[model samples]
Target chain A: MPDDQLSRVFAALADPTRRDIVGRLAVGDATVGQLAAPYDVTVQAVSKHLRVLEDAGLVSRTRDAQRRPCHLEAEVFDLMTKWIERYQRQAEERYQRLDAVLARLQDDEQQQTDPDEGAAS
Target chain B: MPDDQLSRVFAALADPTRRDIVGRLAVGDATVGQLAAPYDVTVQAVSKHLRVLEDAGLVSRTRDAQRRPCHLEAEVFDLMTKWIERYQRQAEERYQRLDAVLARLQDDEQQQTDPDEGAAS
Candidate 1:
């Protein structure tokens, strides 16, 4: 119901059932009946899951006779990928910077003690 | 807490405030007070967000004197990226298969009409 696509996408995938449905759709499109066949839940419940996926733009549907086949829209995944990658890269860079700083400090400390330990070496 | 790491990670990121906190932490680690400076929320609320992030394995923390610095765990993003990519690739492959099938159907139709249309050509 919200316009925040990122949040919607994450929330849409928070449930295992929804994730499973997405997986099945990825292999091929299916009507709600077909998607619900393997689940113990009612068709109405499966329909609700489809609605959530549809709202998140992770899925789309088209009318074919009386059936509305749900299709996976892989392009929607780019949004999540970009967001996750941006943060992941930043975090990794920060960790690398910290490591570099620690290495520099160790080098500085070694230099400071080099003259004192010259005879020992 | 649920043992579902993927769900927890997704649920943690479902909130805009939490996502913003993650984005900030990605750039560098920060204390709760420092992290709370940019947001209108209280330090307690920010702490709660941090706890959720910690539970989701998206963040880690260390005690330094009286301060606890929160660090972003970028490796957790791989879980999400892998899940999203799996479905995206499957969907793309399915689309390609469908296209190939359609192309073959067209070729078969063309072959059937070739014998009759020979004089017209």
Candidate 2:
């Protein structure tokens, strides 16, 4: 539930062609035909991939006369970034704590192994 | 071609169980057995999930005597954030240009529809 948007974004990027589509759309808007021209896949297949990207909120379409141009929506990227950064920060904080605990444990072990080492020093 | 690390991270998060494991590890590090106890799936299944997360660089394990405890690696998240943000920024800049063109087209249409509207106003 928490990962709904991130899930969609991730799933959209899962396919290589869709990722390529995204890469192209990133540079500028393109019609389905224009976007599909570079690939061996049928226009229908490209359409399907665009549909997935659209559903994922990564792509948006607008009518340009007879052609429907797809535009990439960059704001949705923040959804994934927020999610990633949250967990990343959490994990790093956990790692820091783990390091502290490990250091304490090692110090305790040293104390046990060499009780007089501290006194000698 | 641009999505190598992003793919791994997305594919890793595609599994809910693994995402849950990540969430848990985010709060604190846990042993494999501890991570497995909450799920109905066998310890083996959870172990496999951990392996997936491990391969994706989302999770790391450290030996503690006979037991291996998994810790979340926050650094890897940057790889994905970078990718997502890059395309996102691209799309947004493209959008600005598209918007400018759209506004120009709208102005042209207005001029054509009411030829003397500009002169009258």
Worst 10 residues of 2 chain B by lDDT: B1-10
Q: Which candidate tops lDDT?
A: 1
Instruction: Give the C-alpha miss distance for residue A68 in model 1, angstroms.
Output: 0.9
For model 1 the local lDDT of residue A21 reads 97
- Please give the lDDT score at residue A72 for candidate 1: 89
The DockQ values of the predictions, listed in order, are 0.78, 0.53
DockQ of 2: 0.53
C-alpha lDDT values of all predictions: 0.91, 0.83
Best candidate per TM-score, number?
1
Give one digit per residue, the lDDT tens place, for model 2 in B2-113.
Answer: 3466677777876677878988999987999999999999989999999888888889999998778998887887887777778877777777897999999999988787
Report lDDT (Cα) of residue B116, candidate 2.
Answer: 75
B1-121: candidate 1 lDDT, tens digit per residue:
3469999998899889899999999888899999999989899999999999999999999999999999898898999999999988888888889999999999998998888689678
TM-score of chain A of 2: 0.88
Q: What does chain B score (TM) in every candidate? A: 0.88, 0.85
Calculate the i-RMS of every candidate, to one decimal place.
1.2, 2.8
After best superposition, candidate 2 residue B2: deviation in angstroms?
Answer: 12
- lDDT, candidate 1, equals 0.91
After superposition, candidate 2 runs with Cα above 4 Å error: A1-3, A63-66, A99-115, A118-121, B1-3, B64-66, B99-115, B118-121
